[model samples]
Target: MKTLIDYLNAIPVEARDSFAARCGTSFDYLRQVGYGNRACTERLAINLERESGRELVCELLCPDADWAFIRAAPPPGRRRGRARNRTT
Candidate 1:
């Protein structure tokens, strides 16, 4: 499967900054995630997936989660109870 680093490296250098900004994160943070130095948060993964036009899929970004099931489920009206925390 293609990784975030692979996508990052594949894109043009000049576009990196703007892409990162559009993903609501710094290029440095993306670099860290790409290099496996930092964990990619679910929100950031979703943002990257959307901003990258699905180039950086959340399945690859957050491997631990069951993305297929999540996608199959209906959208929640309001989240209940404490948020499920993930360990980076």
Candidate 2:
């Protein structure tokens, strides 16, 4: 079976850290689930969706997420604004 890391790694590298950060998680968390040390959580999944600008978890777990809308990545050549929104 393909592992979570397998899926995570498939995500674009630029999307990785933000995905984890938005998920209110860290790469360690990804490693845990990816390495089979933890179970997936709704919060984590939701955060990832928010981070990646994709609608995977919501489509798979919560029907309400389908309409939740995807957040667009900043246009190419533009970096995200200050990292003030981060919580860690």
Q: Going through the candidates in order, what is the number of backbone clashes in each?
A: 0, 0
TM-score, cand. 2 vs. native: 0.45
* Tens digits of per-residue lDDT for model 1, 1-88: 5688888888898999999999898998999999999998888989999998887799989888788988877677746567788999
Best by lDDT: 1
* Candidate 2 lDDT tens digits, 1-88: 3335666877788877766776788877876866668765666666655655553444443344433334355666667877556678
Off by over 4 Å in 2: 1-3, 11-15, 58-88
lDDT of 2: 0.62
Estimate every model's Cα lDDT from 0 to 1.
0.87, 0.62
Task: Please report how far candidate 2 places residue 16 from its true position, in Å.
Answer: 3.4
